[model samples]
Target: MSGIEYHVSLVGNDSWEGTRSAPLRTISAAAEMALPGDVITVHEGTYRERINPPCGGESDDNRIVYQAAVGEKVEIKGSEIITNWEKVQGDVWKVILPNSFFKGFNPYANLIQGDWFTPKGRDHHTGAIYLNGNWLVEAAEFNDVIHHEGNTMLWFATVDEQNTMIWANFGNSNPNEELVEINVRQSVFYPKQSGINYITVRGFTMRHAATPWAPPTAEQVALIGTNWSKGWIIENNVISHSRCTGISLGKYGDEWDNAETTTEAYHRTIDRALGNGWNKEQIGHHIVRGNTISHCEMAGIAGSLGACFSVITENIIHDIHVQRSFTGEEMAAIKFHGAIDTLVSNNRIYRSVIGLWFDWMTQGTRVSRNLLYDNYTSDLFVEVNHGPFMVDHNLCLSTDSKDMLLNVSQGGAYVHNLFMGAVSILPDLGRSTPYLRAHSTEIAGHHTLECGDDRLYNNLVIAQKDQNGLSKYDSAAFPVFMDGNVFLNGAKPCIHETAPLEADWFDPSIKFVIEEDSVYLHLTCQMDWKNQKSRKLVTTELLDQTQISKLPYEDTDGKQFRLDTDYLGVARDESNPYPGPFEMIGEGRMVIKVWPHA
Candidate 1:
């Protein structure tokens, strides 16, 4: 049911009624008059301001919806245009403004310092300078811009008690004549308070936010953040150019923000979070789908304790933390701290530091059918998480020195994945991670990882010539169960495995090509594996119980699940199907188009 329809246009009045005939001048004006179940339509123009929704909807059925006008270009930017510039030296320009020009939050004065953030021996600020449509790199020293020698553009700023001075090396182009913009707001769309829920944001181009270092322990203000809310739908937007994170369905600020870095400190912080309404009834339950998030200095999508029971699917997340100006522990394309019962599926994540990093307390989480490649560190990193999480039908296809899938956690089930890289498994006896009860947010227990409580089945791993695979689990503390896995091109299997299909001398030369609008995977192999070993149809009943959590792998409703579908949602054969994610296979040249291409 529609409550009201408000329209916002460039040539409109704030005093007028927000109808299409007499539209409002600003989106903030429409937001002020919009009630629950209202619809706000923004017309074609660039809106340069931060949007802080005052209130949320009463329920998901009656949520406030904000959308761009159909087929119209709408851009919401957090930066303002700056035209005043004085040419100082060759390719160098300077701008000086009063400190009060930045209102209350000055990105130039704010340093990027938070929990799990390393400055790499230099001070990094939250400010950024953009020329035309690209962002310039920040210089570590004032003399680095003064004595600059190449074609690279750099920006250096210094803020004092009276004024803030900024210097830029704009090569060949006059800064006063071109479109030079600087960050003014910390977020484009975010709530100032927590528990703002049941809102829908869609179809806008949001960019150029001077966001902060979004560690899981902090509030994680990003280009767009849910801010510990519930029942939010953030979809069909283009978000980019954040100094830190692009999108955050993440934590809210606390007294312990940026103060918990150690293992013991984080564990205590978790306890405090549990006391402060970190359950599924209040926080999380967000849906982030069908958006393009890119060019953030930190993770593209980040959540601390606020990503539980959420669905993040079909998003293209790339170019996260690619600058390498700083290093931290919380860097990835998709980084979540607590991912309890979250459904992360069908996303294409590439060209980041790490593809996915599922940190502590990731029980009942389902990561399925995602395509990850070109990540420098690793494809997927499960750090210190406990048992009963599922990973299925994924293609971990990153190449070179970064082609390693790091599994530093236990109690995991890997099924029908295509690993085109190496694999590493190690136990963590130091930091004891939390594990929730089955399909619930109540933290049942916490224990140090004992290692090798995992089940690996029907995975096809293709390691490089000298790299290794599941054989890394041969030295673990407990015994692991493995069956019907195909190891090729020097990828090894554990000695205790039963019916391991080993093809050492065969090199199925694989190629991933992106042409026009689709991504295709080309590989050549033999078809003898159809009758080599009989495989069981993997189900929750077959995966009886995880050692640490002692829970069977089931859905959020406590129902059993079966792996009867391929990565493309094609139906699999009932009994004794193929071993890999694809069911139908041939002896030679098989080229399949991957879905949700970037």
Candidate 2:
């Protein structure tokens, strides 16, 4: 098919030709008419409709592109502006909206309920109220909203079939004058069907989506979701204020998200997924990059299907999984399941429940060159994977001692990472987990339940005073290899022995000098005992030679990724590199890009 360009504007008519002079009114109209190799340039405006593309492009070279006009501000919202309001009581105002305004699916009537979703004993809606670009706190009941004076909380209820009543406290400001917007739609940009390939959405502000919890065993939804599609590029957008997830790259459930309540149910779901073409040719291979995703209740970017064989890079994801009354296993800034051959690098994740969580069948993945700090929970959590994965060149700085790393998997290699806190290893020794066949997406073998046989090489573990060091639950049958790692500030590097006991590798007489004004934590190693250097105490040999072959990191397209340099773009020595993420650049440390200024 021949390629064409379409245009959309706020003031244009829907029946007009989608040209630069006579643009379409709604993005939904443009989505219906866009074909392969077409470019739909939306002008500066606020559109309040979901753009569900009818179909995707045939190939990568002929993909459809939906982008904001160059240097223009385009906001596609899931909300509608409201102005009519009346004073109800002290610091409270009420507004009645017609039921016909919602069309068919009303988010105010939809309560947030799903598997692993906690409502804290009250019914919470996907509906939200925003006043002048700031979101108000959602109240459980109308009485709670009336009684609450601080934070400008709000409450809404569907009053019969004719109208919906909303009560909110504007905090001494007039509700009629302020810009009030209510969530009216479920998503801003999403395809209804699965396997929509080679679609690109860029440079738009998508907000106020009423999304649900995205579990791996169920159909996952988000503000912008791939919906079990392949070869999608969702980049350079500002996505925020989602009720559940911001960006979803997940699978569609077999039966309306009625899966994943139990282990047997999840296994059945996986079997159905395999039958429905869950391989490299059918699913995954998405690129989500350079996006600023924040203020989400569940996750910044989450997926069960879209995360596999994908690249998520250079994004700023923060303030996620915060202010939710519910708790679950799938809450993080960047959470993924079945992330085989994926790369998550050069991103800044902070102030969330967990920084980066890779759960269940995370084989052949790499987490490198990321700056993770100020997280409420741990920086990295690797759960339930007998990995052939690598985690290297990351600056994991946590304020609490127990918030650095949590490892529940075996066969992972931690190399050249700066661990500024403690580490916890909790392995389940009851049941074995499934592993896929080598170089294929089929389940083949099962690794025995153990957390040992892991490797930690050339890492700098800086533990402060009165902080806990590396600890494990119990000793495993296999040993955890530790080599060329530096322990500073009286930190003890402990490992499990076969006798169900802990063994410390460092001596008590080691001293460390802390530099206060340094950006990087500077520590000078000092040993009080004679002829006992810090490197002499730890063995530099490999505990298991077979595990070394698993360290070849590959990207989503099956290309090998080279780690020849450190985090600061410094070259490493061929024989012996430095301990931490930075290879010693003269005297001071080589500084990498920590925060994105663009």
Predicted structure with the largest TM-score when compared to the true one: 1
Give the backbone clash total of model 2.
0
Off by over 4 Å in 1: 401-403
Per-residue C-alpha lDDT of model 1 across residues 375-413, encoded as one tens digit per residue: 888989998887688899998888763546788888889
In model 2, residue pairs whose N, Cα or C atoms come closer than 3 Å (at least 3 residues apart or on different chains), thus clashing, are: none
Cα distance off (Å), candidate 2, residue 263: 1.9
lDDT of each: 0.87, 0.75
* Tens digit per residue, CA lDDT, model 2, 276-314: 888978788888998989988889999874678888998
Q: Quote the lDDT for 361 in model 2.
A: 75
Clashes of each: 1, 0
Q: Which ten residues in a row have the lowest lDDT in candidate 1?
A: 525-534
Regions of model 2 farther than 4 Å from truth: 156-159, 471-474, 495-562, 587-593
The Cα error of candidate 2 at residue 47, in Å, is: 1.1
* The candidate that achieves the highest lDDT relative to the unseen native structure: 1
For model 2, where is the 10-residue window of minimal lDDT?
529-538
